[model samples]
Target chain A: MKRIMILVLAITTGLGVLAYTTHSAPQADDVKVISITAKKFDFTPGEITVKKGVPVALELTSSDRVHGFSFPDFKLTAKIEPGKVTRVVFTPDKTGEFTFSCNIFCGSGHEEMAGRLIVTD
Target chain B: MKKLVLAITVLLVIALMIGVGVFKLGLVPVNADVPPSGLETRFIPIAVHASVANHAEEQPNPMVPTDENLIAGGEVYTVMCARCHGVPGRGPSVLGASFYPPAPQFTVQPSGYSEGELFWIVKHGIRNTGMPAWGRLLSDQDIWHVVAVLRRLNSLPSAVENSRSKLH
Candidate 1:
């Protein structure tokens, strides 16, 4: 009977902590949304600034050809197809500057496609 | 255990010998005159992709595309880039053929590089090619001006045409 009581207390304590943690964190839907346009070899409004801990919804639009958008530091990659909108929701946990680039091959100057994301504490 | 170690050692030495032989014998094509092998052609794109993706600048071309800016860009292009890239109404340049991977003709091939992309290329230039880094020679504003001119490489605006000198 004592063992059973101890096991039940432990389980209840674990459940309480899990519930608190889940409720404290922000959800993807709660983050702010920003639209970015990707063209032959550049992204408009190249520098983006966001607050740490808050999630952001990035809507990517390709103006001309199919381009790739990748935040290598964050291990995030998204494809931006012409005439289509690609939505990516991410929460930056750390505070620093991150570079995002196009991993796909477009043309001769394809390599010069990169942008920066600045996160503040 | 001793026999196993001996066998492994023999195999390792054999592999090293083969590697050395390939290098000393000149079995691999090292000359730029030779067209790139199939494997090299396949690999070069991946290497260039990784390099450009890593180094490209994020900022858009800061200089506004004014008429003066375009003319300056045209003059710079005719001076710095035309020796290899060729100029308008002048047939292919003899120097263009000298390069292993021939210098691209802007009149024939229009690279869809962005303004910033063009600026970066003109400033830093490409490696393993005839292109040389102009960043040390040109200022940032001048590079942007060059990019403005490249935008209309094939279809030169009248103003850009007026900017070109007879020497080009």
Candidate 2:
């Protein structure tokens, strides 16, 4: 009975550690780099598509004022300031349609400053 | 009596097993886009409040609410909190609402937390939430200044409001 209990504890602990360590690390594939431009209230490439489970590198630049790129689906956000390139890297874990929007209150059309991210499996 | 106890134990074990299986199977929704359930909105704050109570020190804000401090706070807020918490005149931040717990819209609804509580939250941040600890990036004075700004969001001085307005 003592040995059985010890074995169960060991297995549970091992499984917990394995799950924690190996859950979100995707294999090293060529990062799909995409450049996005932000202005008053819009992303230049209004729509972006990438493969699920692959790493993506986004090079974000702003032409005027400070803009925020918020992709809530992936819990990603970056500040795009004029005269600076903000690089954001993330792996899309889910395959679906996600909306990326400017969170910063830029101007009258800030609400409409949104784009779509289609992650394909 | 023995049989009844045994049966109850077996039933409890089965229910526990089912609960663990459901969680492990990913039946629980983790999507950030969906509005938080009533249970989450109600229970999570309770946990946060208790944790804050335990960890937060009862330190009063050292910074006075002068134009200089308030304006400084506004600047920090614009660069840091505005994206998640929102700014004045922007109706219901879409990005703020998209977080799992949803970042509080300080512009629309002023924080009810006390100066000390707000200070602790801003400095340390809530765990497992969208809030990030600014202690590393911002100085202690900056945190206190922002706390003052939060306390006066509804009634910011004209100078501070004007500076914020220029951003929009």
TM-score of each: 0.50, 0.55
Error of 2 at A70 (Å): 26
Task: State the iRMSD of every prediction, in order shown.
Answer: 11.7, 9.2
Range of the 10 consecutive residues with the lowest summed lDDT in candidate 2 chain A: A103-112
- Return the top candidate by DockQ: 2
- Chain A vs native chain A, TM-score per candidate: 0.75, 0.75
For model 2, how does the per-residue alpha-carbon lDDT over B1-168 read when each residue is reduced to its tens digit?
999999999999999999999999999877787778899888989999888888888877899899998987887777677878888767668888888788899888888787888888987888878888665445567689889988887789899999866755
lDDT (Cα atoms) of all candidates against the true structure: 0.77, 0.83
In model 1, the runs with Cα more than 4 Å from the true position are A1-121, B1-16, B25-27
Residue B2, model 1: Cα distance from true site in angstroms:
10
> Over the stretch A10-42, how does candidate 1's per-residue lDDT look in tens digits?
999999999999888766567888899999778
Best of the candidates, lDDT? 2
List candidate 2 stretches off by more than 4 Å: A1-121
Where is the poorest 10-residue window by lDDT in model 1 chain B?
B133-142
Kindly list the per-residue Cα lDDT of model 2 for residues A23-112, writing each as its tens digit.
956544668889999997789899999999888999999999888887768878777899999999988988989888876555456657
lDDT accuracy of residue B140 in candidate 2: 68
Per-residue error at B52 for model 1, in Å? 1.1
lDDT per residue, candidate 1, B55-138, as tens digits? Answer: 777667777778887776776677678888888777677687567667778866776666766777777788877787765445
